[model samples]
Structures are given as structure tokens and as C-alpha cells.
Target: MDPRYFFFILFTLPTLLFGQINENGIKGYFSFDICEAVDTTDVIFSDYGGGVSGNIIRQAGAMNCVMDCSIRGNSFSMNGLDEQIVFFSGFQSVFNTSDFSIGFYFRPDPGVTKMNLFTKAEMCADSASFTIDYNPSSNQIEATLAQNSSIRTKVTGKLDPDRCWQHVTFVRDDRNSILYINGEQADLATASTRINAKNSSVLVLGSNLCIDRFRGLIDEIAIYDRAINANDVDDLFFHPEEIINRDTTIFLGGSVQIALSKNCADSYQWSPNAEINDATVAEPLISPTATATYQVDMISSDCTAKDEIMITVLDPDDLDCTEVFFPKAFTPNSDNLNDFFRINNPYTIDELISFEILDRWGSRVFFTDNPFEGWDGNFDGQVVNPGVLLYRVRFVCKGVEQTQVGSLTLIR
Candidate 1:
């Protein structure tokens, strides 16, 4: 094999790398192709007849497998009923390597279902060994290594399969094995079934014993001759096309235009039911009637990404209507200019304290008992003539007394 292919297989076979050791210590590592496939019929090792299907494909001149499977159903399962349907490549020689590592890339279909893919022995006997399995019943992926028959280290969680393709790696030093998901250290298992496999014993995949076979696809199986590090596992998932960074927002109208970080997907779907259908463009203009949260699912030929935003429609009639104040001055005259004294009030007043119009002679000309009633240059049922009128007013505001004094010009 070419040197580049060998390096590719060494780095990209496991999803994660852990327990990296130097010349002084023991180190473990692993990786796999999330989109590639492995064919067991061609290899000379134990053949459980496990093959690849669905989005599984081959990369040219690369030693890893890549899976392009879509996330539709609740579970991604491999039919292990037929022994050779799905299995690993080399389980017999798992312990022969003094320092070893393993990793693989996977995108579990949404929902619940468990599957097993690989296992290894420490010495020559299979009595005590390590195993990695996915439990669909519990929505957890777990790894078990032999520390003792009584106690072992195991890590499990409900990982959202819809998020993205994730790399899972586990590394075993002499004393302990560390689990890692997506380049991050996970829980550790100290007391595990210690591996005891003989040298030259073939490594096995797809089956734990004669049963417990894997019910999913496998690809890019690789066993490093030496231990590797976490950085090595991260490289498998660092494809330039897999990183998606886009800013998505929603306005009153259902219009979305997001610039993606990479170019792999060509279609998008907005949530909250858009007015127009069949609009699969990356940035589609849509209008939703009610206020709602919207999410966009971007689909590539091989993978999918999604984001969400919220939309809220406001009522147009929600306006401001407050009291408007006009200067307490007006010239009421027959000249057709400022013919009336009025107060521009937009709100209803609760009370009228006092309203009085006084002439220049310092005598009251008019007064009002109603807050809405304004002086029309009239007093005692008689129209007052043109002159300068002084008005003194007092009113109660919020139970507090307030007063104002102004003059009005009446010319008629």
C-alpha cells in the first residue's frame, strides 16, 4: 500500500484517540471513516459476512470507510441475524501490539436502538477482554474493558444523533482506558474485563461470541501498531466540507437567507409552515400568519445541518394616544382666526377643578363646571366682545391640587 494510504488508515479509522503515551509509557488510539464501507468477504480473517450498505461508499486510494446515511427513522440497525451480515475485520490480533489505538466515525439514526461493532482480548484467551457496544433500548453507547471480573469502567449517554456525525475514540494505557467523544475526554473505566489475548490470534468483528453480532455497517477498520493521541482522532472528522457555520434569523415575514460556511448541502426547509411550498432554495422567502419558532434543515448530498429562529407579528393598531397640550391662549374673533378657546385633550379627564375667564377689568366673564366644556367667549348666555381675557384655573391631578394662570384674546 502507498504511504499516504497507510497514514490515512492509521489516523482516520477511529472516531477518537485517548491514553496517548510516549516512549516511557503505554498509549492507546483508534479512528474510522463515517462514510466509508468495509467488505469482509475479501479479507482472510474471521468472516462474519458483514458488509456495507445505505450511504456507505468507498473513497479512492483511501483506507477508511465513509457513511452518507440520512437520519430518517428512529433507529440505525445492522441485521446481524445472518452471522456474516455485519462484523469486524481483525479481532484476533487485537492484543499482540504492545501499544495500540482505535477510533471510528458514526452518525446514528434518530430514535432508539443498540448495536455492537467491535471487541478485543488482552492476552490469548477470550475469557477476559474489552467490548464496545451501542444500546438502542437505552439510547447510550458504551465501552467495557477488562480490569476485574467484579468491577469495570463504563461511560454512556443519550447523544442526539441528529446533531451531526461524531467521532468516538477510546485509548487504553497499562492501568486504565479513557473514553473520548468528539475530541473530548469522557468518563473512564478502571475496573474492566482485562484483555488477555494470545499473540497471532486473529482479531474479530461483528460478533462478540458466536452471537452478539453487530446490526449496523462498518468501514475504515484500522489497528495502529502503536498508541496515538486525541489530536489524531480529531483529524478524521475535520473534513473541510463538514464544518457548517451560518447565521440564521427570522423577521415578521418568513424570509431566511443564511450563508453557510461550507458548500455540501443544496436544499433547505423552514419550519412554522411557510406560505409557499416546493421552495427548496437555501434562502427562500416565506410568510407565516401566526407567531412561531422556525428551524431550517439544510441537506447535502451526503449530510444534513439545521438551525432555528423565532418570528413574532405585531398588531398594527397598537398606537400611542396621550393628552396633547396647546398653549392656554386663543384669539376668538369674527376675523376667522382663532375664533374659539379650546384645549386639545386626547384622554378623558376625571374632574374640572376650576375654569374662569376674567376681563382686563379683573372681573370674571365666564366659568365652566365641566372639564369637557370650554369657554366660547360667552358669559351668562351672552356673547362676550373682543378684549384681552385673563383666566385663572385650578384642578386636581391624581388627588393633588394644581393651578395655572393665562390670558386669552377675544376679538369679535
Candidate 2:
């Protein structure tokens, strides 16, 4: 084995051990650090010797480390005999005996006509491998995996070929193998295959058939010795961010409930004080009397986490009318005190249809359609002499008829 291969194998051993085990004890894994044909000048390293590298020419907001490799003319190629480009990592050595998974960001080189990007293993060589390749003539990205020829799976698609990064995964459980692209299961040639390879070699990145190299970008390569389910893969692809931040404003007498992204810590703290602090509590009810700002902070076991929602409690009555109303007499005496007869009901009346004042003679001295336009003891827009007047009011209240009749002394 090449010294670089030995070092790669040594570095990847921990991935097989770190994953949470299922009943069958399988691990998941991935990696994309190989000297393929594609350039790697602008790759961003997450840690020492690990990060993302690929050529992204078009799509804006394309991740620097996580890019589509199958775009532009850039690609991984292997033309020389015995030339091997190891492009991926995170695969367990033994197959058929242990469940395992591999996932990474990939982009197919549009220029290549035939390509494969997955893992495979050959019993003849006692090797396991994964590969991603493209054929320029076919305009396809093919993924293949094998364990000593005993277990093999292949999936293909007419990919975007625009060199845009897409997420992909290949998983092997006790009885099945699957391929996923962009977090969804892609078509496969087979689902069930028995692995017979023992002590499989370290995972290969970038190349499969010793000279068949991938010419694209790869990022966030991860591997697990444990087999992961569809839901797990979905979570990994869609909600990779550790923290969740949200904000909500609710009316008084109303409530709000928040849902955090998955795989988050179960510890929670709600500001303005909550009835409960448990993270999984659904619909934690809180009734705030006054306007309050509530916050929920969640902490994961890894001590890395985020918060969801700054809940702002609003006062329902803040939108209510609080003005005072008082009974008044209209004198029409040019005295400001009783010049107009008006009732104050700031919260009660929206509009008045008609308000009229009639003399003992039964003639109308004042009438108005506006609630604000009260009886100023006027006739035809002219002030009338002060005297006792009978008033009749007909108005609409809450879409209903309301009639009020009374006598008022309009003194001059």
C-alpha cells in the first residue's frame, strides 16, 4: 500500500468507531481528499487536512467547499495504466458483516461522457471501493459500489452536468444497498446484495479503475460504520446547521408554538419564564398578562446549539379605545360649554347615521349624518334660538339598529 493510502486508512479508522450503533452496529461515512484531475486551489479546509475542494464556475451562492464537480470543462480523468485516484474516504473494511454508509457532496463534470462516483470492493484484490464518474458522450453520472464482487450496486442518472454540487449517499445495511442523490433515493440496479469481502481495504476517494478519475468538486465527505436510515439521511442533508433562530409576534390572548430543527439538544430555556423548560415539550402554553418578550435557548450535548424564536407578546387591549364619555347639553347660546349636544363613546360608536332635533312644532331644527357632527341647535346650517328640544337618534351599532329619543333643554 502507498504511504499516503496507509495514512488515509489510519485517519479514517475513527469514523467507523464514532457513529452511533444500531441493533446491527453499522457505521456511516464520507471523504473527498484526493489528487484528482480537478484543480483544488480555492478549497476551504474545515480542519487539518479536511475540507472541500471543487470548481464552481456558474451558480452564485455555491458553497466554496461544497460544489458541483460536473460543470465547466473541469473533470477527473485517469488515462495512464495503473494510475489510481482515491477521491473519497469513510468506508469500513469488512462488508456483508457490518452495516455502513458513505455520503458526500459531488458535481459531475459535464465534459466527461462516462463516470462513476461510489465505492466498490473486489475479493480478488481484497478491496472495497466507491466511485463517481461521468462519460462526456453519455452525459450521465454513474455511481457504483462493490465488495469483492460478491456485493455490488449501480445507479445512474442524466445529471445536471452543469458542475453544480449535489449531495449523494451510498449505504449498505445487513441485507440491502441504496443510492441517494440530493438527499433522495435515486434509481438503483439492485437493492439486495450479499457482501463476502473480509478485511476490505481503506476507502478510495476520486478514482475506481486505477485510472478512471473524477474531475469535479467534493466536500463534506463523511462515513459511518453504521447503516443510516432514510430519515437520518434526510436530516443530515436538509438540517445540517446546528442552531435554529426564529422570531414570532403573537397578539394578546393568542399563543404560539415553535419547532426546532432535528438532532438538536433537548435542553431548553424560555424567556419571560415558561411553565416548562423541557425541550421536547410540545405546545408549552404560556399566558402573558402584559407585553413580554420570550426566548427559547436550546443546548445540545456537544455544547453547541442554537435558539428558536424571540416570542413577542402583544397586548390585545392596546388596540382598544380608552377615551371617556360624558353627557352634555346643547344651549346654542354661543356659549362654548353647551353649544353642542354630543355623547362620548369612543369605544362604542364607529359612525352615526342620523341625529335630529325637533321643536314642539314638530319642525326639524337640526339633523346630521355624522356622529362627530352633533346637534349644534342649527337649522339649515344656521344657529337656531335656544329652547327646549326633542331629539331622536337612529344609528347602527355592531350592524344592528339602535334608536334613542329624549328631550334636551337648549338654553340661550
Residue 250, candidate 1: how far off, in angstroms? 13
lDDT, model 1, position 255: 48
User: Residue-wise lDDT of candidate 2 within 1-412, one digit each (tens)?
Assistant: 1111112222223433324322133233223333232233232221222221222122222223322221122223222222233433333443435766766655433453344444344433435555555555765556655554556666766633322445666676755667776667876555355554444444445444443555554454555567778866764464322234356555566665555444333456556574334434433565555545555554443333334445566554453232224354556666467767875543355446677779989898777776666666667777667667787777665567677787787666
Give the TM-scores of the predictions, in the order they appear: 0.44, 0.38
How does each model score on lDDT?
0.47, 0.49
Could you tell me the TM-score of candidate 2?
Answer: 0.38
lDDT of 2 at 316: 40
